[model samples]
Target chain A: MLKLPSVPGGAPPRPGTPAAEPASLKDNASEAAISALGWLDERTAISGTARWVMFRKVPKGTNWFYTLGTSTMMAFLSQVVTGVFLAMYYDPSPNNAYESMRHINNDVFLGQFVHGMHRWGATTMVVLIFLHMGRTFFFGAYKYPRELNWVIGVILVLLTMIMALTGYLLPWDQRSYWATAVGVNVFASAPIAGPYLGDFLRAGPEFGATTLSRFYAIHMLLLPGLIGGLIAAHLYLVIKHGTTAPPWIEAEIDEDLRKSEA
Target chain B: MPDTSKNTSPYTADRNIPGAFEGETVTRRRFMTGAAHATNGIAVGMIALPAIGFALGPNFKKLEERWEAVGRPDEFSPTEYISRTITVVAGAGETGKTTVYLRERNPDIDHEPEDEYNQYIAISTRCMHLGCPVRYVPASQRFICPCHGGVYDFLGEVQGGPPVRPLDRFYTRVKDGLVELGPRFSVNSELKRFSPRDPAQDLDALGQYLFPSRPTIRKIPGT
Candidate 1:
């Protein structure tokens, strides 16, 4: 008969042996935690999903480079958290946007830190995404069945860039205004539909009353939803296909198979 | 259940489905599925179409033309360009206000055929390169963009750098002794008038056809 391990710590004593008393508060706490987890798991069966996502079989030669995607995701999560809090104080109106940003930086408690995290986290996320993409390319991880994942990743990259561009104008300062103007003009540089696209971005022929608010909606609402959704798809594919082995690590033929062939 | 697999007929009645009307091509099950799908599509569209239209509504909206008086006709000089601040967009406070360079039309330099709107040349400070505000340097008699080094001559023609065309100009009309700057209009390399276009949209030849005028704002016809 197979003996299953006990949940808390050690295996139960033999049937004839004397039962031991549970010792220490730590053991009781761990036992309580385990039972709670089991209780939840019994109803939801969520542990299987957690196990499936977290305990994936990574390919051989997995190294520090493999962490870049997770690092990028972490950076994005940091941006999301910081951005949510920042939105509480941000005023999208052109009349108050600069003043509100000042209030956030100078008046609100920990506002500067949260705002700084979001601002810097954006750059960190961009850099990390590029590094992750470079890793996938250099390792040739984008081949075969993983091509769809690569396409999804490219879309994510575009979404991230849009997030950056739209988010830039939230500050409502001279630089933000000018940079966005230049950026929209770049969009207008495209032939045929470019002019209409520019109008769509500006919400008019010129940057008007709603331009700042438009950018705010895109930055905080539209883009985050899209980026987050695409990221979920990207990660689902990543887990489904597992990961590619480092290109430097070549396959080794079995000695028996080689001998038979010889 | 009837053994109808071998029938493979086009009509439900031919297939021997129970309660099927004669000559009915569509099965009740297929019709129900299509109805449910259509109902779902309509429901989704009811929510989605309005939201999409709400977002894109601004593209087709035409803004009202605004004219702001900058100075009296005598205040402007034909030989020298003077800067005047005017509101390009309302309700945006100082952000909407832009600097326009105003001067009386000098026939020696201004070759474009004279009209009621062009008697006083009102040059838009918006750089033709990338929409950066260009400053008129009195010493050099040139409009210079600080951001990208785009230079335009006194006539607002692209003199150097990456400017695709001349700096945009506004309609000038002397209303009640005051020179009023009206809606902006873009000019091609030959200084011919066209609807206002965003900076970097070249107005030369095929450029106009490639980058069509937006529906939101248009130049006054027969001006």
Candidate 2:
């Protein structure tokens, strides 16, 4: 029941949209506004903080490829803002599911594009997540303590696929139908949990109205809820362990020796 | 709020990284120094291969589900069975595909509402046998897999061959003149339910006709 915030004319912005707009824009409006928080007032204050705690220095030759992760995060943030716009129009019902999509596609403001973005965003998220993992692997970032984060990340990756799977079925279209069929077949590999999992997903052995409700709950409520938790743990670990160092760090073993000799 | 005396850096950083503290102060100019400049062209070297990979393959759409449209109940003829190819639309450039059946309602045909006039059954074209597209032989009133001669009845119930189960069906219903299909799912058992909890009749192929639970692969000695 999270409502989008009311736009001046459109539906209210979805609650919790982290839009950094006019507030920063209006702050640039006048000299008085600029003076109100006098730049120099805190300029010197910024220098007083724990330097290491407040900032970080790069290794002498780290690569810019690291920017992809940063950009990917920016993309995810963009998805969050747009996703809020989507949830407002989506109807969590077996009956109205298709129409709800149609509404989002044709009726809501930028509905078609927002839905397109969410759909594409999902595809992008999965791809980016893999790219991120591959980058880590090639960099040997998964060799030590970082492996735990990678494992957690593996869980996140699977969770992301699951999120897409469950959300895919929510549309209640043929694509969802057959694709879920094939998807459930993957679980059949679990032996004991396979059949039951399949049954659980299809709602008594065949996808039907009840199955739609089931997928909807998982897609909207269960997944985001779980992802939020996992991501929290991940972010905490990331802050604790820090970004993976470049190959040069390991390569520097000889350089540090040379520098010391010099 | 004017002091630069108390800040401390976290990293024992090399002097090149931007946003890193040397002692207690960080200058944007320093932030964008050697660390940023030194490796300006390296991102392409690192991430290009994966970027190219993303464009050329299916590596397969790990995403479960695509899209299928429901046909209107009116579009179907009551007596004539329609084996309409239901096209599924999926983004990311996949050619989505599926099939749904629409047949006439014979109220007096002694079946449940699910099997009544205009039963909408959206099924996959793949045969439960070794995965071949099934063809509905209208004359024989059965689904025949051309690959290995596996045969199925109208409901995709395996009549004879190597198929383990019936052809899968996407959930089907009629609304707003469109026969809406839900996310595709396997229709293994030939169980039928038209109305929820309040079914008009108990219907099953075992009850209605000679539908085999599975088609056999072993040859009969003398048939």
* TM-score, every prediction: 0.94, 0.50
Candidate 2: what lDDT? 0.57
Candidate 2 segments whose C-alpha is farther than 4 A from its true place = A1-54, A248-262, B1-135, B138-223
| Tens-digit lDDT string for candidate 2 (A193-229) | 4444554564443344556777777777667777767
The best candidate in terms of lDDT? 1
User: Poorest 10 consecutive residues of model 2 chain B by lDDT?
Assistant: B194-203
What value does DockQ give for candidate 1? 0.82
- Candidate 2 iRMS, in Å? 15.5
iRMS of each prediction: 0.8, 15.5
Residue-level lDDT of model 1, residues B90-209, one tens digit each, is 888778888999999999988989989999999999898889989999999999999989999999999999999999999999899899999999999999999999999999989999
Steric collisions counted per model = 0, 41
The 0-to-1 C-alpha lDDT of every candidate, in the order given, reads: 0.90, 0.57
Q: Tell me the deviation in Å of residue B150 in model 1.
A: 0.6
